[model samples]
Target: MQERLNIVPFVSVDHMMKLVLATGVERFLIELAAYIEEDFRRWECFDKTPRIASHSAEGVIELMPTSDGEAYGFKYVNGHPKNTRFGRQTVTAFGVLADVGNGYPILLTEMTILTALRTAAMSAVAAKYLAPKGARTMAMIGNGAQSEFQAIAFKAILGVDKLRLYDIDPSATARCQKNLAGMGFEITACSSSQEAVEGAEIVTTVTADKQYATILTDNMVGPGIHINAVGGDCPGKTELHRDILLRSDIFVEYPPQTRIEGEIQQLDPDHPVTELWKVITGQVPGRSGGRQITLFDSVGFAIEDFSALRYVRDRLKETGLYEELDLLADPDEPRDLFGMILRAAKPTPVAATVGAL
Candidate 1:
C-alpha cells in the first residue's frame, strides 16, 4: 500500500502534456466543463475570494486559493504580456492540492496548460448558458496561446464552427489560423475587431494589452450577442468600453473579484450584475430575450481551479502519468522528527561494514 502521508504525486509539464494528449484535448475540455458545472451548482459550499495579486510594470503575479470543507487548493500564476518579446509564454502557472483535515499536500501539478484548458472550458460553460440560441459563429479578438483552446472548447461545448479572428499582430492571427486549420472550423482572418465581429453571434475579446482597451465599442456591439470578455482580467486591464457595459447585462463568476479585475470594473461599484452560479443552478435567467445582450465578464476564479485539481487527481489513477515525490517527512513516531534525523546521521554499523569487506 502507498504511504499517502509522505508521498505527493507530482505531475510535471511532460506528464501534463502526456495526460492531455492521451485524454484528447476536446474530450478533456468537455469533461472538465462538466466538473466545473457540477461545482458551480454547489457554489455555496466553497470558500471563495478574489485572487491575491502582486503588480509590476511589466506584468502581474497572482495566487488563487480556495477550499471545500474537505480539500484545499491554490494556484500560483503570472501574466507578463511583454514576455512574448523574449519568446516566453505570456502566462505560466502551477498548483497544489492538500488534504484539509491533515494539512498535507496530496498533489502538485503544472497548471500552465491546465489553466488554458480550464479558462476555455469555463468560458464555454458560460457561453452555453448565455449565448444566443442557435449561435454558430464567434469573433476571436486576440490570438495568443489561449486562442486555439478557446476555439476547440467552443467547438466541443457550443457547436460553434465558424470563427472570425483578429489580432493586432498579423503573425499572431496567422498562428491561430494555422493551429486551428484542421479542426473543422470555417475561420476567417480579419484585419480589425470590427470586421471580425460582423455577422458573428458571439463576440469574444481576449486581447493581451494591459490597458483600458476599447476592443468593442457600444455601437459595434449589436443587441442579441454574447460577449466573452476574457483578457481584461486585472485591475487597469479591460477590453469593452464602459458604454457597452451599460447596454449589456453582465454575468460574472464572483462579483467582488470581477468588480476589481473584470470588465465590470469599468462600471459603478454598485451596478447590478448576475452571478453565473445562480444561472447554472436555475436561480436566475441566463438569456432572457432574443434581443437582450448578455456579457460574461470572466476574470477566472478559485472554484474553477479547485474543480480542475479535483479532475486531475481523479485522472492520475487511470493514466498513472505522475511521479511519487518524497515531499513530507514521515518518522517512526510523529513527534520524534529530531531523533529520526539523528538516527540517520549515525551511519552504517562497523560490524556490518567488516562483514561486507
Candidate 2:
C-alpha cells in the first residue's frame, strides 16, 4: 500500500505577488477582513498561546504559533527599528502552515509584505466596529512603511477621504504623501502630532521607532475618535498616553498577548477591556455612545495572519502560481523511515578474503 503523504507547499514572495495581483489589494483586504472576522467568531475552538521571543541589543525576534485542531500555523518575525539605516525594513517576517493531524507543513511563505497587508486589514476591521458611523477624516501619526497600507485600508473600507499625516522624520511624511498622491485622498501634512490628530475622526499610529513614544497625549485626542494603535505593538513601545487607554473603551484581538505587547501594557493589569471577538460575535457592545472615545489596541494577532494566508492561498489557485516544494518526508515504507536511507547508501563491493574465495 502506498503512503498517502500530505506534503507541504513552498510559497514565496513571487507567489504572493501573483496572489496580490490576481485579487487586487482592495478585494484582498475585504476578503481577509471577512476571514479574520469569521475566525474571531469561532475563537473558543482554537488552541492559543503567547509568542516566543528572542531579544538582542539591536532588535527582537518573535515566533507566534497557533492551531485550530486541524491546521497549525506560525510566523517568524523580527523588529529592528534601526534596520532602515542599513536599507532594510524595520520589520521582516516569514510563516508556515501545517497539518496538525500528521504534523506536516502545508505551506511556507515570506510574510513581510503579507504582514503589512494583514495589519492594515486588521486595523480597518477594528475601526469598522469601534469607529463612529460614516467617519471620513483620519489622522495618520508616524508615517512609515505601514502608513500607506493603513491609509489605503481606511479609504477602501471606511471611505476615509481626508488624511492628516505626521512623522518625526520629514522624509517619511514626504514618502507617505508621494505614495498617496492622486489616490483621491485629501492629504494634509502636519508639523506636530497634535496638529495631525486635531479634528480627526480616526487616529492611526503606525510608527516604526522602538521606544516608549508618547506620540499622542490626551489633549491631542478628542471625543468620538477611534484610535488604531498599530505601532505600539511590542513591549516598552507605545504611542498613546496611558490616560488615553484609561479613558477610552479599549478593544483588543487577544487580551493575553495584547496585555504584554499592546499600548495597554502601560495600564493596570486589571484595566477593563473588551476582546474584539466579543463585539464581532455580539457578546458585547461595540460603540456605546457617539461622544465616547474608543481605542483598538492592534498587536497584529496570528489569527489575522492565518486569515491572510488563507486568502492568499485561494488567490494563488486561480493564477496557477506558487512553487511546490517537498518539505514533508515521504518514505515508500512509512514504518521503515530508516530503511529509505539504508537503501540509498552505495553498496560497497564486499572484498572476500583470498582463503574464503
Best candidate according to TM-score = 1
Off by over 4 Å in 1: 347-357
How far is 287's C-alpha from truth in model 1 (Å)?
Answer: 0.2
Task: Kindly provide the TM-score of model 1 when superposed on the true structure, using C-alpha atoms.
Answer: 0.96
**Model 2 CA deviation exceeding 4 Å by range:** 1-7, 342-357
Q: For candidate 1, lDDT tens digit of each residue in 224-343?
A: 999999999999999999999998999999999999999988888999999999999999999999899999999999999989999999999889999998788765567988966776
Clashes of 1: 0
Model 2: how far is 114 from its true place, Å? 0.6
Full-model lDDT, candidate 2: 0.84
lDDT of 2 by residue, 246-331 (tens): 88999998888999999999988988989999998999999889899999999988888777767666555567667766565554
Instruction: Give RMSD to native, each candidate.
Output: 3.5, 5.9
Which candidate leads in lDDT?
Answer: 1
What is the Cα-based lDDT of residue 249 in candidate 1? 92
What TM-score, computed on C-alpha atoms, does each candidate reach?
0.96, 0.92
